[model samples]
Target: MAFRGSLFKFLVVITLYDAFLTVNSQAETTDPTKMTAAILVRVDQSGKGDYTKIQDAIDAVPSNNTELVFVLIKPGIYKEKVTVPADKPFITVSGTKVAETIITWNDSENIFECATFTVLASDFVARYLTIQNTYGNGAQAVALRVSGDRAAFIGCRIISYQDTLLDDTGRHYYSNCYIEGATDFICGNAASVFEKCHLHSVSEGAGAITAQRRESPAEDTGFTFLGCTITGVKTAVLGRPWGPYSRVVFAFSYISSAILPQGWDDWGDSSKQSTVYYGQYKCYGRGAITSKRVGWARSLTSQEASPFLTKDFIGAKDWIRPAPTSFRTASKPISHHSDGNN
Candidate 1:
């Protein structure tokens, strides 16, 4: 009878151990965020991932989301127009490889209506992807339109013919990006900083790289390119004034021979030549020669270029963050529709 009691006690201990294991396994599977700590969803062309469409994956994220949702897209050609709504903030759409993962469209109607990927949400991030509008040269086709404040792009390739990057309105940051276009490619009034980026102009004739539209002097809107490289197929000007008070600065950048000697254009309105603030500082290469630059454009001094040199120009220190490494699975799916406007 004593031996029987010992066996019974051993069986009880074994049962308790199995129950503890079951509860722990359920916790890890049900709420992985407790261990990994980020909301993650995956989009794949194959049936392996959670969603087949990228838009569907984005739709799964809740509106007015305060936490970061990391959407991992598998390598494939996504031929859909994607828009991040204004209510959904703190989202990151990342790709494994820029060359393989492409988001492309052939919309050539209007600049406002034709972007392949539009980011209308603040505190958004895009990484290692190519966003292109294949509307070659006739109309104003925008590959990417960023209208949200504090949007950031890393290792992205933005390509189009005219108005490639409609940096519409925001405090944006592009790092290690490749932006290519022909006319007014990088246009907008966003106070942006392009760091270590490559701007390639595919113009066959005369084209302007930027058309900054800062309407008033009071508006703190401008474009600042630092440690960037500019190349082109044919001659192009550094920028033309899309607004009377438009401002642009290129500092510590490499300007290729494709740039026109005048450096800037008045956009046929000579009045803009005086109001537009076009400046260059410590830039090297054949196109950066200031001797033939327009009289209106300035050769900035060290003191003048100080304000535009760092991420501080856009107050990036407060909002900009690194790509997250850990992740949690997505929860509570939501629905949304795109009307082309945010």
Candidate 2:
């Protein structure tokens, strides 16, 4: 009788232990955030990898993480609204290929709320991916919204019809990327630089490419496009003033005939013409006519254009090294124009 009671107790203990393990496994499966390990977070929707959702992998990362977290995303169309919060810095999100890996969402008109991929952390980097907003006929559909400091996007494609890419805040660097939009597509108050990029326009009617907002004279914010190609509908203007002190410069860029004769707009505010600084240099194309450009849109001098042509303009020289070698060379001479002397 003693041996029988002992055996029964052992069986009951084994059953309870097994039940505990089953419950714990279910919790880990449903809530990946329970794991706080700062390690490789691979995302695959095929159920062959660690996490099925990108956000779930990101949630697994510890808050205020200073270490480098590489989120390797596989080739798939992930229809998710991803956000790299401010607390999570030094995170690199990479994909197999730009065309193969796509993270997209449909957010329209609401610049503050609507972003397919929103980055609010510093020292963040993204490569070889396409961030897109599917809302084509919306008021202001933004594909990528970046407000992080020392952030960079490489070989990425940002697509939308209106307000496609928002460089909202901080210093950003975009290289060899493609941005497509109609009106104020690349608009923001951030001090950003675009190198060897392709800016495409798809306006059925009339549209403006950029809408930079530099509210205060003390605020050092502007849009600088270097070694880029601007192509789109044959009637799109270069940019307009979103703020009184808005600043935009296109240096060594190839402008398409699609650009309007008046390269810059005053946003129907006559006072902005005097305060806004819209300039261009060494831009060659049928549409890059200085004579037809607005009288207020002055041609930048070598001294003025040299500062913005370098990577230091976005403060990427110290942190972003070896990659942006295009900005390392000395600035080219500024072409003197009869009407450009300000």
Candidate 3:
């Protein structure tokens, strides 16, 4: 009977694995955009791998159903406009090195269409490039806007004064990246996760995280910080409830002295303080003390620390791998930065 039970468990595991693969295979599937622009498109039609501009390669590939266009962006500062439409899926933009490749746009509050790169498509992946809205401490400037259904950022750096990451819709993932912002800069209403990344606050007075305008339970408009570091010079709360049902969690993360003892603010909306789900689990540091934490804030128990807080939490078990590497930590680590960047 023991042997029979063991065999049954093995079969069940196999069945579950197969089911997962099947589900992932169909999730947003792909689009059919190919990179037919040789291996390089030289300004003077020069030699291989030396394109005239990155935009040339981007323009060569046309968006279609099941688009799988891979553009190997060479190292250099690319200053231009990038618009990924809704039907363009599987647009894997990989740079040679994180430090070597940069895409910059200077659009301030007054500048219309102020987005460096806008992703309205689904299942798009970007790696090793620094995307910045070099609007210089202005308002309504967005560095990267993810309006797509499923988007991923790996080994990248996003810098801006305000609205750095505009998560307009769908599920998104950020791993091994650096994101710095001010005010309600990192605001959005999407199911998103920042895994093994760095979140920095630039201004003396600005919020680190924000879940703007999420009034629905079905829309997972929450930000899950998994094994990330939150540090700044000024006193920073975890976040204010931008919407009524706004949700966020810092699981297995590190908090610095820059955070206040209370850890959160009401944003002048007392009713939102009750409905929003804000919590922390297994975080350590000077600001980890929940003794003075807000009444609405939560410290999760071990049982509640399962899929919702683990690597599988926030749906990270979905499509987020490569570039930044997968989340392979058996347990959370203490927060300590070598460069004092944290």
Q: Pairs clashing in candidate 1? A: 38-328
Q: lDDT (CA) for every model shown?
A: 0.85, 0.79, 0.69
Pairs clashing within candidate 3: 30-66, 31-65, 31-66, 31-67, 32-65, 32-66, 32-67, 33-67, 163-185
**What TM-score does each of the candidates earn?**
0.86, 0.82, 0.77
lDDT of 1 at 143: 96
- Judge candidate 2 at residue 331 and give its lDDT: 18
Weakest lDDT window of 10 consecutive positions for candidate 2? 325-334
In the range 1-342, model 2's lDDT, one tens digit per residue, is: 677767755654454333222222222132221223223556788966656777766654545554445677999999999998887776678787999999999877578779899999877778889999998875888999898887889899999988898889999999999999898999999999999999998987678899998998999899999999999865888898888999999999999888988887887899999999899999999878899888999898998898898988977765552221111111121111212222
| Model 3: per-residue Cα lDDT over 182-220, one tens digit each | 766667787787889888877686465554657867765
- The TM-score that candidate 2 achieves is 0.82
Which portions of model 3 show Cα errors greater than 4 Å? 1-50, 65-67, 109-112, 311-318, 321-342
Candidate order by TM-score, decreasing, is 1, 2, 3
Best candidate, lDDT-wise? Answer: 1
Q: Compare candidates 2 and 3 on lDDT and give the better one.
A: 2
User: Judged by lDDT against the true structure, how good is candidate 3?
Assistant: 0.69
